[model samples]
Structures are given as structure tokens and as C-alpha cells.
Target: MQRSFILLCGLLLALPLRAADPDGKFAVDGVGARSCAEFTSVLDKPEGRTAFANWSQGFLTAYNVFTDDTFDITPWQPQELVLAKMAVFCRANPDVVYINGLSALIRSLIPDRVIRDSPLIAVRHSGKSVFLYRSMLARLRGDLNAAGYDAGAPDAPFADGLIRALRAYQEDQGLVVSGLPDGQTLNALYP
Candidate 1:
């Protein structure tokens, strides 16, 4: 299932840019047009979750293709993180369209979008691992420094100092003290 999902993502990346209609509107199909309330109701089922994931992957790929100065709109997030965010948005705004919720999520992520490709680094803690762009690590270091966490030199390797700092920051924010840049940690740091 994971392999197929990865293949689908690769195909999504190659999709051609779509042209807008004469009225400056784009057509939304599939699960995108469903209400947030409907989306929330389906979250517990694997098929429904998979459907939303596929639609979201395609939508984000399209955004990357069409948006200026964007190589990836969500360079730091995993599919699970994105879905979690969507679930939260849908639960809060049950009357809104799912696509609109995705749009709002994208808007919030704009500030962290990767404008260019960068080397990825593996960050692992507590048996969980995530790959993050080096540029994102630099940005994380900067944010931590700004928040008085002192994450060593910006763009430096992820060392003991960085881990300690991350732990401190997470503890201060009442988040899981994972000592790794998890989705919640990144969101809190960036926000």
C-alpha cells in the first residue's frame, strides 16, 4: 500500500498544469467537493482516509506545479501530518467544503514552502524517523534560536546540542518531548 501510494505521488508530480476556466474558476471533483462534515464522518474508515490522501496528494502536487517559487508546498510534512491537519480543520469548520479547508491549510503553509530543492537529512528519535530538507533544518534552528532555545549554529548538523534544545522547546510548549522535529513541534516553531 505504501509503495503504491509513493508511485501515485510520483505520477501526481508529473501531471500537467491545468488551465482555469474563462470565468477564472477551477472545477473541483471527487472527494474535494464534499463538505467538511462529510469528511469528518469518513475519517475512521481506511478507504475514506485513503481517498482523501490521494486527492490531497494530487492537489498539493498541482499547487507545486502552478505556484511561483515553490518546489514543494509541504516539504516538511508527511501524509499523516497533512491528514491530521485536515481532520482538525474539518472538525472545526464542518460546513465548509473539504477543498476550501485544504486551500486554507495550504495558505498557512506558504511561509514554509520550499522554493528550491535541498539535501535531505534523516532525523530519528524514539524509533521514529523523518526526512527533512536541510534548508528546513536551518529554518528550524533559526526559529529555535529566536524562541530562546539556542539550537546551535543555523545550518549545523543535528547534534546533541540541537536535541537538547528541541527537548527544551517542546517541554516549554507543552508538547511531546521527543527531541525530534515532529509535525507538532514544527507547527509550533513555525507558527
Candidate 2:
């Protein structure tokens, strides 16, 4: 299969005018996703266009993953509209990493521990990690106390996250390149 970025790039060129970001707060970074109108504008045919409409339902189903601040859309419907479009995109391109990245963005916004504890985060259904309710909080910053990750312990102060997430957070924060989520870094990330 083709790389998701190449598809995103082609999608940008293939799409119409408007802010491409789902947030519309920024330009299309090519790293995440563009807005719904932009994506829909490019649908020249009836089949794919119709498909776009059918899949929007998942956006609402999965909306819980995002943080609350995502509500800041100047015209809120656009983000929702794009998220709805993204649901269609997911059906067509389930393997797309950027889609997963966007999903990550959605969850990245929520803050409450109880909400984060919900199964929508990452339900490990089959393996050892099963029954696991991972949180964006651990992956976010400052909340890396891992309270949601390993319960019953006093937030052991253990550093959290997979290697990749830690690396991304480190690079984004201009922190020392330890590639680990320390309390200082976590606080900075969530802060």
C-alpha cells in the first residue's frame, strides 16, 4: 500500500480551497488531516462522495478520545464536519497511520481521569495488556504519574509511554533527548 503522507499530499492537491486542518486553527500540516469541506470538495464522483456521508457516524462514536479544548473551533461545525469526513476516510483507508494520529489528537484533549479511564482509549481485549485502559494522559504531559495505567499504586512516579511517543514529545518540547517521559516533561507536555 502507498504511504499515508503521499495520500495526504495527493489529497491536498486533489482537494479544494479552505483551511485543511480539522481544527482549521492552522494550515494543513500534511502530518495530520485537513478539514471536511476541503476533503469533500475533491470528491468528484458520486460513489466516494456518497461513501463520505455514510461514514461520518464513527466521528461521533469516537469523539470521546479528544481533549475538551478541541471545542475551540471558530466555526465549530467545520471541525465536526471534517471529523465526520475522517470517519469515511477511515473506512477507505483503515491502515493509514495519519488517521491513527488524528485519533490520537482527539483523545489528547480530554483531561478527567474517569473519562480517560474509559475503554475507548485502548482496550486490550485479548492479551496481557487486555483489560488495560491506557490513557492519553500518560502520553500527554505532566500527568505521567501513570495513575490510569497501573492502578492501586501511589502513582509510582514511573516514566510512561512507548519509545516513539516519548521521542515525539521530547522533540516537540525541546527537552533533553533522553527519550523518556519524566515528571518534568510530563508536566510540561500537559501544562
Candidate 3:
């Protein structure tokens, strides 16, 4: 069956192929993806049914935020979204992850919880420090503007802020604050 074929390929490949980001740019391996179409179209293959399933699993693994019980991508299921979702998250509200975490902290102190959960912060820290998120976002935004996105261009919606977004995502994911995804982030983002 296709599942077995995927398993066989996984065993033979030696290296696990990472999935592309939302804009179909950053390849699974973090290389500058040349053809967004090619990367996103992997699942379009005749044998893609299995690949799509695996891709969805890996994508959810990377973030650990997607779950059958939690997400309701009914209008847009995760399986249908694996290719485009990451880029959208990274491009738009690149710092929202951190900012939202900061917001949650301030609310918690007032004995008010603005959001129920934030993957951006460890819950222990969430109730106490807002500075971590703010300073991190500010520094990250600076890096993003200096070298990241193109002031929000539509053609290249991903912009240059991705590195910053990725780093912030990495830091929040509890990996080293190297500001570089490396192995951990890749695995986390595409586990």
C-alpha cells in the first residue's frame, strides 16, 4: 500500500525531507525554495495521498499545536493547509505569537486571562513576565525589518522577517535562543 511505500522510502532516504513554509518558499530543509509550486505540489502526485498524510503529521509535529481535538479547519482542514499555513503565520503577525504571549501575562496578573492558551510561552513564565515576550518581539522585529521582509510586499508576502519569526518561534518552542531554527525547530515545526 502507499503507507508501506512511504515507510519504505523513509527508511531508504537516510534524510527526512522537511515541508515548505506557507509561502511555499523555505523548503523542508530550510533552503530558499525556488518553486513554490513544486514544493507545494508534492502532494499532487499520483502517490500523494500517502505523502499528504505524512506531511500533515510532520507539520503538526513541528508545532505540536495541531490536534484532531483542538483544531477545526473544517472550512480549511489541516491536511488541506499543510503547505500554506506556515507561511501565512510567518508572514502576517510574525510577532503576534510573542506579543500575544506578552498580552496574556499582563492579563493574568489582573486575574484576567485574555487567551486560554499560548504556545509562545511556558505557562509558568506566562503568568509573571511580559518583558521576555516584548523585548524578544522588539529585537526580533528590528532584525526582521533590517534584513527580513520587503515592507510587506504581496508578491513575496513572506518578506525578510521570517528569520526573526522563526527564531522567536524557536525560542518559544523551548529550543536554544540561537535565533536559528536548526534541528530542533525543524523537528518541532515539522515533527
- Could you give the C-alpha RMSD of every candidate to the true structure, in order shown? 6.8, 17.2, 19.8
**Candidate 1 C-alpha lDDT tens digits along 8-127:** 999997887556777879888999999999888988899998999999999999899788899999987888889999999999999999999999999999989999988889988778
Question: What is candidate 3's lDDT per residue for 1-191, written digit by digit as tens?
Answer: 99999999988776645445667554242211223333334435646435444544554443334332322211112344433443333344444332233223223222211122322321122133221222223333444445542222322222234444655666566786544423344335433
Q: What is the model-wide C-alpha lDDT for candidate 3?
A: 0.37
lDDT of every predicted structure (CA atoms): 0.89, 0.42, 0.37
Candidate 2 lDDT trough over 10 residues, lowest sum: 123-132
The candidate with the higher lDDT, 1 or 2, is 1
TM-score: which candidate is best? Answer: 1
For model 3, give the 10-residue run with minimal summed lDDT: 122-131
Give the winner by TM-score: 1 or 2. Answer: 1
Model 1, position 131: C-alpha lDDT score: 84
Rank candidates, TM-score, best first. Answer: 1, 2, 3
> Between prediction 1 and prediction 3, which has the larger lDDT?
1
